[model samples]
Target: MFDQSRGFRDDAVETCPVEYVVRKDGKPFAFLNATPALATRTVTGFALATPEADWTFERI
Candidate 1:
């Protein structure tokens, strides 16, 4: 799955590609790619960065 979020600035946007997986026990998890697309306006100019992210869910 692909996702996008608005940056601190209205004109900036961050995008990432994710993947979901289920273990043998049926537990599910998701993670984002190492490199994500970023658009931010900095004092110097536009800059890019990579963020590490992961997600896990549990039944209540």
Candidate 2:
């Protein structure tokens, strides 16, 4: 699901634990944590977007 055209980049750390880090065009984007949290924004640009649905939790 990693699309090069979208200019998405991902990384992870070992010593300090974190799920993963995501970036776009070499800038800070998102941090996918180990636990789920409320979705504060609506998904638009990604495929299978559920704009109509009241998405409450994030799990990736």
Candidate 3:
């Protein structure tokens, strides 16, 4: 009898860049840093809802 066999295949991929946050109202928004550009800035606070605090979170 004759032997008939198929060849094996290896498939793999690495991403050059990845997208994380989606845009909101044509503007980009993210709760956490994802991409290199997003991870560049230094963030240390969140939006607070208080009468005393001058700065608060608002949708642009």
Candidate 4:
């Protein structure tokens, strides 16, 4: 059960190393926040968004 509302932009592109970057929902941080360390301001990690897509930890 995958929720499509989780910012999975452009679901048509079936390829990866696709970055899963999520910035603060509002204006506070000047950068696009990513994941894994959500406790801090910026979260950074990897996401194999679909069977075809994945964001490697290196690019982040």
Candidate 5:
């Protein structure tokens, strides 16, 4: 998935990297960092609205 919300920037602001992993039970799991980013600076006291449950996908 490609997100272009912040446009193309070298600082990678508002970017969230996602990785897929397999759990011990062999179930696919997605790990993502929802932390907000600032250009060449540290973000403090910032909160993003994230889903409370894990994301699920179904094949058509």
Candidate 6:
């Protein structure tokens, strides 16, 4: 994922990559690209919304 949200310079905010893995019915189902800050929240929300499935994130 390309996240243009953080950096030391305002005009040159570097993009950060985040990867998300979500499972359904005990099987991997989705791979998402998201912002680093939002990655954790996204996984948490998914786990909460879909209690039967598992979710996780990987920093790249």
**Highest-lDDT candidate:** 6
Top TM-score hit: 6
State TM-scores per candidate. Answer: 0.15, 0.26, 0.20, 0.18, 0.19, 0.47
Report clashes for each candidate as comma-separated counts: 0, 0, 0, 4, 0, 0
Model 5 steric clash total: 0
Candidate 5 Cα outliers beyond 4 Å, as residue runs: 1-7, 17-24, 29-60
Candidate 2 residue runs with Cα over 4 Å from true position: 1-18, 34-60
| Higher-scoring candidate on lDDT, 5 or 6 | 6
Q: lDDT by residue for model 1 over 1-60, one digit each (tens)?
A: 333453244422233333323122233432223212211122112112212323222212
Ranking by lDDT: 6, 2, 4, 5, 3, 1
Q: CA lDDT of each candidate? A: 0.26, 0.36, 0.32, 0.34, 0.33, 0.61
Could you give candidate 5's per-residue lDDT for residues 1-60 as a string of tens digits? Answer: 444885565554346443323222234443333433331121111111223433332221
Task: Give the lDDT of residue 47 in candidate 5.
Answer: 15
RMSD over all Cα atoms, model 3:
13.0
* lDDT, candidate 5, at 10: 54
| lDDT score of residue 57 within candidate 5 | 24
Superposed Cα deviation of residue 50, candidate 5 (Å): 21
Candidate closer to the true structure by TM-score (higher is better), 3 or 4:
3
Local error of candidate 6 at residue 26 (angstroms): 4.5
For model 2, the run of ten residues with the poorest summed lDDT: 35-44
Give candidate 4's whole-model lDDT: 0.34
